[model samples]
Target: MNLKKHYLITMIAILILFFSIFSILTKLFLNKGFLSIEKKYKDTQINIIQTLLENEKYSLSNIVLENSYWNEIYNAVENKNIDWINNNLVYYFSSQYDYDFIKILDKDKTPIINYSKYDIDLNINKIDIINSTFKNSQQYTDLVNIDSNFYIISSSPIFDGLGNKAPSGYMIIADRIDTSKLENLIKKIYNFESLTFLSNKNIYFNIKYSTYIPLKNNNNETLGFIKIIPKKDNIKDYFYKIHIIFLIIFFIMLLIFIYFMNRIFETINSKIKSTVHQIDLISKGNYNIKLNSNTNIEEFDMLSNSVNNLSKTIKEKIDENNKNYIEIIEAIMVSLEVKDSYTVGHSHRVANYSKKIAKKLNLKNIREIEVAALIHDIGKLGIPESILNKPERLTDDEFDIIKTHPEKGYKILEKISYMDNIKHIVRFHHERIDGKGYPLGFKGNDIPLESKIIAVADAFDAMTSDRCYRSKFNIDQAVDILNENKGSQFDPTIVDCFIEVLNEDMEFKKSFAL
Candidate 1:
């Protein structure tokens, strides 16, 4: 991965982490908050039940304090108008006080008035408060209905208040709270936003359809659970929309990553191309080429400047080397010309032409060709002037003496300490690739590359320039002869290489005209 890509990825990863943590915290907080509200509502219901019970107690006690009302009913009991008394009392109390029924019973707990007329001889022993009211003549108390609707029965004994144990009769007041009204009130209070349930015994109810927040009292125990089942609310839609938005954000980040990666590769590639071009110029002896300093980067700038400085130093060294090489070649050539004047400028022209040939052949050892061409005739001093200066074609014996120059030059040059590897050219320059022209008659592949190059240079210069007795051939005709004799008098590759350089639009062609 790229450093810039790594940085961007890390940023995205941290952002996701932050969001993940934020969402988790938000859920936890919502859960705790909902539970707190549930506990509050449960407390409110408990308080409502307690207040209603207290109000019931207050109204029941007031009925016991009103003595004259029950005293008038007892007078009707004495009149033996039992039907009138039962109908009148039932109609008065049931219609006025929301009582379920009003009943008047005899001393043996036989009902003299059964308001609804369900049973007259009903056993009321399960009514604890009613038993207390009949036995101890208490004024008002509650009782349970043993064989009736779930009801609250408030009873008062028909007492004379004379501290007597006997009571004339009892006043039974009963009422039943409506179950439908209770259900409607609970649903209204805790509405559609939440699922609310109330259970006295171990019953449970679920109201909503999404997330569930369990109900609890103040003790923090889950009394019942309310489920908000997975459904579509505005909040749910909002979070789902957010998720899609972030997914697109992540995808966009990936595309941006690829963009930066490609940019880095292209930038490095351009820098490499610039470096290669500069190196090619340096190879062509263009040392004046300087690298740009303002590349807008550090490492490439350093590398460019370093190469320019190195090429600059190498050029300076090569200039000094050329000076020494020229002086040495000129001195040796002048001395050889003193003995055989025909070979005076032959070495210099060959050295000059050989450099261009080596370049056209893509040869790396050009210095070897220059050195060999300049000193090729240095060994002609050992040959007799009769054969070297002969005006006509030499006899085989005299020609054999002239051919010894390559080996003689090798032996002489091998003694010079600074010319290491150039001795091969001097010794083998006369050796042909086809073993047709040489002091030793060495064959193809037995020739050194440098020697082959020098042989082509020596032959080309000799043909194009005036010799001791032969007139010079034109450059084009000389080129044709060299090409035609490839693989016989010359190494075919070097002969072709030399001709190609001679035909170039270079300074030599323009300076040296036929």
Candidate 2:
């Protein structure tokens, strides 16, 4: 992937993972924290209900104790005034105090009288319970379930109002838990909404924010359970709301970050492409093409400026080197003209003909062929002036010496690094397409294209020019000689192209007008 897409995907993935983990961790933290808060609230409500129930039991016990201390009740119990006991005690306590049941028992633990407001079954085994629980105290209180009804029971011993006599009987009073004031206290004062009385069997193990208060007899037996539920906690909902808000904010931030990142990448990518385009143009010899180095990015702008500077410097150096190379070539030509003036003219005509043929063939870098043609006979300078400008035909040995010029020209141009490509063209210019000519006898396609063009131009110039052997041939004779030797001594395509150039090209005809 490109920089923009790769960076975008990576950042998106990282942010998503971070948010996912953050969300999970936040949820877990909230759950743990809320669980602790709910538990504390539940415990607090349970403690309040326990206090309310205890207060109720205490109030009932106090009522029983006051009634037990009445001398009238004590005297009545002593004299066995059953009617007085029934009318005064039962009617007074039951009607005024909302007691579910009132019971009077003798010191021997025999029940003397029992009155129930609701006429519930009084099958309680009170003697054993009273004796077992009152062995240590004269007053007692307990929560009991009788006939499927839960009650808070309080018992105290009857005594003389003078405070001198022992107790005559025991007074026990009870209030059913359902009709008791505890429920109203829990609901009104404590602000609890749900209160339920459940038998031990009906009590559930799991209840939402519900507290269980057990009602037990004096024997510590659980008779029933009280369930109280408080209001639902809204903190979890609030926390989630806040978490959602944070997530939305984080997502918006991520989008903003991506937008800015895309802009940054686009800027960087555009600058790089612009720099690369300028460098490509320079590589293709368009050194005059300038790069815009004013991009906002510092490093890329610096690189662009550096590239522009390098291109300018290289172009300047190349121009200076080219001028020096032309001066050297001219100086060499002057020396060659001093040795054999004819050969110097011959080199110039060959160079002109090679340029025309090269252009006619649509060859690339026509300047390279022109340069190679100009210097193709540079090695002839090594030959004696007698052989170079001889007025007669050369012997076999002298011809052999003349043929060594191409190799000498290769040596002369080899030391110049800029002429490396055309040096082989100079060495192989005398080679024939039939493998009959040259130092290495290279055949046909084995010869460089520039060398083949120079060979045709050289032969044409030699045929038309005055030579040590004979007078120069006429234009028609020269054309016929080139056509006759097309595939043997010269590249046929280049020879044909040169003949067409001589006939059709106005520049060539004017330059060589006979």
Candidate 3:
């Protein structure tokens, strides 16, 4: 009787261990599977929203272009016919076309006629005409934020009767994006819980579970975001039900074969427990962990070998991924260089100069600083190549468009979570030390140290490199310029460090042909 009791106790312990291991593995697998399914669904919904927004912008552009290209409208605006303007542009177009706001601006961008369906005032002075220049006939669309309200704005130049010469003025149309309109559209198309349009300030709310997609203009600058809050579903409950059913079957099988299967079950359970522990270590980023299989069971040995191989494979893959990431960054730099002849090899030189300055200052994370310097002008990709390579000085409107590149670069790099530390450096590299720099006018110490370092390097490279508008400056001339604007335009310390670095490395200076 005592022997039978001992056997029963041993069988019960084995069964408990088996059930515990099974439950953990099942839970891990099920959770991963369900999460993947949820991600796919959410991604699909976000893509739909992006497509819908693009289509809306396209439609708005078409509407504005139709009115702007009319010869009669162009002649009326040029001749300053008040009766023609009021009857056709103000009353007829505003009422029949159903635009929220319609305005005609002269060559100076001053409004000739302003009409609004809503109470919000229109600020024509703040409107950007970078993409709507008379130099080209292309229609431009932008998401404009005025007084905390967003609008889809389209601008097209009004050409003369001959339709061949420069435009006399611009015809502008805007459609407001209100909460009711957004909610109605979401319900009609997505059938999701709700869609929220968020500004940069409110983007952090419910970030983990919600889908936050950046809304970009025709220039690819991020204007705002579309946040999708998905309706909750029973994915977890379904997986839980499946797990319970499997556990029941497992418990029944163990009970039926308790006496006969005791020794075999103990061996299998021991091997599985060891495997699980090693896998857990690997999951926790300990790729060095390994398992040993001496059970003499073919299946157990194969499983052990597979786990070891997986660890080795994972390590190799991680190394390869790191290498590939760096290569990709370099490739992007090369592509940017290709876009503007003046900036060819500009990023590489800036990176080299930044690294030297960083070393002189004994800054931490020097590699990150170098990488940021290399891609400092990545946002220039969004700027029109014509503007980037334009030989003449930029107009106020053109410079405003140029100033948007830093923010554009920030948006692009922020998408890569691992690049968070360096992204700010890329964004603020153009910032002035005196709080006069663009996108965000951060002052003095508010600018990141890495950005300060890159700013000096970027300026040095620009001065030394030949541009479309001017020839390259000699070493003394470039250094003098840096010394001249040290405190106001650049961090004085970083500028001094770079100057010292250039003096110390004769070979590097020779490479620049200084």
Candidate 4:
């Protein structure tokens, strides 16, 4: 063979070797990475479902607690006022609480008033289960399976009145954990495609991709399993797309290298070297770098212009991808807000406030801080709407559930590579400088500066916004509250900067005006 043909054969061999290595690495690294991420995503979804179940139990317990501890109910039971029990307790529990079974037992555990939604005879086995588990020292809140159906039962000792310690009898409220209820909760929280509750099967399946999370009772005994059939088009697809893009770029680079090698001896060496350097810059993400080829050869000039045009095209695609990413993030934030109507536009206001504070403090990456502020509450989507929109005060349990939002938000955003920088900020936005914050409770300088800024902004907007339980605070009151807790709940420097920002910016001030 001639020299050119010999060179071509040698280059083809090299290309084949390179392709084999690339394919192996892509499978080992890219596929493995995708599997790892898929596992994490499924784990997150399972945790979310577990949290949702816990919240539902807590909510049901609260409902039962509210009714059981009331004075009127206690008096009605003590007086043996059958009419009062039938009219008030029965109607209220059935209609208002939406409980499937309402049973009021005497101090001796004798059933006084038994009511069921289906008008069937009260299950003697359920009463036995309640009696077996009830402790005089504490209230009973648990999941009980009655005749193959799961129910969340809350049993509280009946007191004579609020703050009364002596128990008269027991008030038990049971709500069936029906498929419809679980589906609704899953839909609200995750928007998952399909969720199945499996019973008495091997919890550990040999399946490669199926997700299985065990459903446990309050006692931590595995009762059943939640099988989540994940949506096929999940976040893994996003990472796969990234890998595909990398593969495409690799091929383009390889072809360019081969083209340059073919012309190495014939073309002006300087021009080929310059074109290769430009390609290197493009590979390094400096897409604006251009080649000034003056070799006077037609091929050299055409190659230079082609490289430049490719750079522009790549830059445009990058810009478009960035724009699309921002839109997706905004859409996610909007979806979270939509779940709780009372907090509509709250995130936007927080972002604006955060940006203003960042500017006032002369902070770097002001845009990133603002974006973090916008998504700080994304975890709130995991919280139940009943707790979020509750017209009354939140119980300590409810508040604890609410506090998990920051961590939930962090878990969600941490999965996206681009969101790594802001994930901690989202997680720690509620952190106090005094180490009293939840999730991690990082104190003072340990909390991220972005988080600190978002905290102040979050607090100000929360206070200024009208909520279901409280009227909107006037600007002065909000400012005074911020000042009161500056060093304790919030970072002092961020607070001061935010206060200055609010005072100087009329538009920002007017935006929060009551």
Best-performing candidate as measured by TM-score: 4
Q: 2 or 4, which is superior by TM-score?
A: 4
lDDT, residue 27, candidate 2: 53
For candidate 1, give the lDDT of residue 330: 66
lDDT of 1 by residue, 1-514 (tens): 9997797677557545644553454334434433443344333434333223333443444444343145556666544458777567767766666565566765556667767533333355656667777777665444233332234456777655432445566666655433442344334322234333333346444433333443332234444433333334323343344445434544543454345544554564566567656756664557788888677755456556655664555555445445544565565567578757778777778788788778887778787778777887777755655567778888887777788888777765653545668777788888877887677888888888777777888887778888756788887788888888787877787776665665665666755554
Q: Which run of 10 residues does model 1 get worst, by summed lDDT?
A: 188-197
Query: How does candidate 2 score on lDDT?
Result: 0.71
Off by over 4 Å in 2: 106-112, 126-128, 133-137, 189-193, 217-221, 229-514
After superposition, candidate 3 runs with Cα above 4 Å error = 1-12, 15-19, 22-26, 29-139, 142-155, 159-277, 285-301, 305-338, 351-374, 381-384, 392-401, 408-423, 469-488, 492-514
Estimate the lDDT of model 1.
0.59
Model 3 scores what on Cα lDDT? 0.73
Give the alpha carbon lDDT tens digit for every residue of 161-207 in model 2: 75578778777777888834566665443445677778867557556
lDDT of 3 by residue, 321-403 (tens): 45645765775666678766766888888899999998888888999998998888888766666678788889898899899
Residue 144 miss distance in model 1 (angstroms): 99
Model 1 lDDT at residue 18: 44
Query: 276 in model 4: Cα distance from truth in Å?
Result: 15
List model 4 lDDT by residue over 192-276, tens digit each: 5676666754556735556777777856787777677666656455545555654665566456556776665344445545556
For candidate 4, the C-alpha RMSD (Å) to the true structure equals 8.3
When summed lDDT is taken over every stretch of 10 residues in candidate 3, the lowest stretch is 233-242
After best superposition, candidate 2 residue 323: deviation in angstroms?
99
